[model samples]
Target: MIAGGERTLNVVCVKWGDKYPAYYVNRLYSGVTRYLDRPFSFHCFTDNGDDIDPRVRLHDLPVEPFESELQAAMQRKGRKGAWRKISLFRPGLGGMEGQILGFDLDVVITGRLEPLVDAAPDKVAMRHEWRYEWKGQPGGHGSVFVFDPALHRYLYNDFAADPVGSVERNKGSEQYYTSMSAFRRGQLHYLPGSMVCSFKYDAARIPPLNLMMEPRLPLDCRVMCFHGSPKMEEAVEGFEAGLLRSTRPASWLKRHWRV
Candidate 1:
């Protein structure tokens, strides 16, 4: 709430290294602009801002005491782990106030975003790890998250206090640490699965069937997450890493993943 009692949404993303280029951020801004039907400010925290959209508020990647070690750990896993994103959990992130909605650059927005914002307005919310839902595992997927910086400052404080120890205990997974920390305090909720889905698991057909039929976007999904293989680029054209991990060209993905 501001001077006029008007509340604005704060949409944020991070581009720490060269894994994704500037276009990823630019197109993400375009998607949010097209879908979110409310007043909002878009922000990007990155190591390089050379070619990003000018309308996006850019800030240098926030630093932490163990950033160097965190970076090293991420590299060890081929950059699959996003340890630096923990920095965003810090209070006053980019000096902005209010509830924050975050997306990984690899996600493709497909439907209305308001539902996601309204899902868990006060408590910290994230997508339940889809892969482990069947096992009754409790943890969050980092792709999409929403929280108030004021209330969730402890997320960063705890990590900063024991970065290395936390990494070792969580098996170098930031999302694991984040989800369990909030869950233990009874302040964590999972966004509806139909809204945010894994591109590989939910959208694409399983295995051999994928070879014959192109991936189909789930009818009710709002954001499709490309966590591992066949990222937006590879999926748009087509990708075939192997029998188990593969996808045919997704025309719908091509239609939405653009600036």
Candidate 2:
């Protein structure tokens, strides 16, 4: 929906350093292209673009004066997850006119993304993972969120106002700020929990009697988000330990990426 054209959904991911290797991004790109039926463009915003696949549009990470200061703070001991705050609200992001879906690099796509793009046009849509809800109060997980660039400028503006304080107030958590900002604007919509199931909570917690049960494909779920401990690496580990069944790498991914 760039200015005056049909609204094609746009999906984006950000990559920096060696924390997540290029194969992960490439595999995600393959999954989106294979599963999504709607017209869309997949892009990766990254600091290191050399090793990324050519099929994914590589945009340089937006640079600003405060970025260096943020980087220094991120280097301090016990600063894991602090970088998420700065990366999620980077300046000049989502300038494109269509709906933008952002995914964390650690996730593995299991279904179509069109449902997310087709969600309500005005509200910012995100998975309502149970962990974020406090004592029945509503909240959202920002690991997978859809927003329109023209509408959510305040997301970055508020962060820019007090970068350091903003990080501290939200404890450097992107989901907290995203939910708070959306709530303030009265433009937040929660997607069903089944759509973004946590592998650790949903998949791994089934009793031993149900250990052989096949994983059910959620009817309303269009995206499966991997947040926290049961990440791709952990899934691999669980399979190795016989606590989980191994899944073949997505066929589309194998066809495109030999590894």
lDDT of each: 0.86, 0.64
Regions of model 1 farther than 4 Å from truth: 1-3, 66-80
Per-residue lDDT for 176-236 in model 1, tens only? 8888889989999999999998888898888798888899889989899999887899998
Q: How does each model score on TM-score? A: 0.93, 0.80
Residue-level lDDT of model 2, residues 1-259, one tens digit each, is 5456787777788887787788888878877787688777778878788767887888877675567666665565544452443444543454545577878876666666666666766777887747656457656777678887568777777766766666666655667667777877888888667666555555553545224443343555555556665456545434323444333222222232223
Minimal lDDT window, size 10, model 1: 71-80
Per-prediction tally of clashes? 0, 0
Model 2 worst lDDT window (10 residues):
248-257
